[model samples]
Target: GRPPEGMWLPETAVDLETLDIMAELGIKFTILAPRQAHKVRKIGQKSWQDVSDGRIDPTTPYRLNLASGRTITLFFYDGPISRALAFEDLLERGENLVARLMSAFSEDRTWPQPVHVATDGETYGHHHSHGDMALAWSFP
Candidate 1:
């Protein structure tokens, strides 16, 4: 089968039906706020008309396999952590921030996954003064 027209929607505010539409069009995966996954009740269910319970699991990613057999993997960003790093003055000093962030996951020593930090691109410029420079200096 041929691929359908590709379109990008900002904010990606989509429901189950929207996902179904995308699946029908052959969309493989999409990044969206975890809130969007709220409507997902058992696996393989469709219809975004249902409301979510407002609880989101951030450890693993969620997948929605459409009738077409094409799977859409959804990753729920850590809204609280991202917002804190962006809006709050938590990570004022880049070195301190990096140390704290690294120390958080390093406690286990056995943990295999690497620790990471993600935030709005503008956070470096708009939120914190010299934030970009701080990040650059803190890294390596």
Candidate 2:
């Protein structure tokens, strides 16, 4: 399901009507690229204001509530970290990447919930050579 008002598609190509559509369909939330916010003057300014107010902190997740009382959670990805793993040669070593990720979450002792990594699925065969092998070996 798509998110209401604030849900931004990656490309940010949709229009305001899309929000109406999402609201009609009961979509909760979605993520968008930074550039997407710049398209609409009003919305874009508000987004920037939120960022300035620490409401859009990149290091932590935030929650947005719609007028209908539906809630949507938003997580601004760490662009540098995600880009490093996506494009840097060092990430080819799955062990190194896994260690970094594990370290990032190690402070949390509430165990049992698995850590899920999200990335473009095509990265396995199309972007990085031996990417599939790297993941297979690292995950058991």
Candidate 3:
């Protein structure tokens, strides 16, 4: 009922050309792996802080000014937590999953922070035994 707003690239793959295409198509945002973010900086600022170590603040969405003069927002999901959920034994207990998700936020910050976990679709019912049950328990 509405115009498209976002696009998810296969394998989370991304490049400037793809980004420009998305922007031209009026796509507002996309999710990306934290490692894909090379640098970041405050809006309207000149300096960029390198995220080569893969440590990025997942709380805020960053604006990418593309070469086409169109902008797109990027959200970098938490890599380690996503990996733990998909590969580690996190789904063995729903409580463990909840705890890990909670730890991603900051307690003192007045503003809200996002805990984005991007993982394979098979992670729900195939990757770990009873993972779908664990996910349901975590939410409820």
Of 1 and 2, which scores higher on TM-score?
Answer: 1
Top model by lDDT, which number? 3
Misplaced by over 4 Å in model 1 are: 1-9, 17-28, 39-53, 99-118, 137-139
User: Per-residue lDDT of 4-106 in model 2, one digit per residue for the tens?
Assistant: 4455565435544554456557655555433333222223245434343222324344455446555554445444445555777535887876775565454
Worst 10 residues of 1 by lDDT: 107-116
Task: Show model 2 residue runs off by greater than 4 Å.
Answer: 1-8, 11-20, 33-59, 67-70, 106-119
**Per-residue lDDT for 84 in model 2?**
57
TM-score of each: 0.59, 0.54, 0.92
lDDT for model 2, please.
0.52
A best-first ranking of the candidates according to their lDDT comes to 3, 1, 2
Which residue pairs in candidate 1 have backbone atoms (N, alpha carbon, C) closer than 3 angstroms, thus clashing?
A: 16-48
RMSD of each: 6.2, 7.2, 1.3
Count of backbone collisions in candidate 3: 0
Ranking of all candidate structures by their TM-score, best first: 3, 1, 2
Q: Compared with the true structure, what per-residue lDDT tens digits does model 1 show for residues 36-118?
A: 56555545556554436535544445677667566666655555555667877655777766765554453344435333345
Worst 10-residue lDDT window, candidate 2:
35-44
Report the lDDT tens digits of candidate 3 across residue range 23-114. Answer: 99899999899889889998778998999788988888889988879999999899999999988988999999999999998887667798
**True-structure RMSD for candidate 2:** 7.2
Give the C-alpha miss distance for residue 15 in model 2, angstroms: 7.0
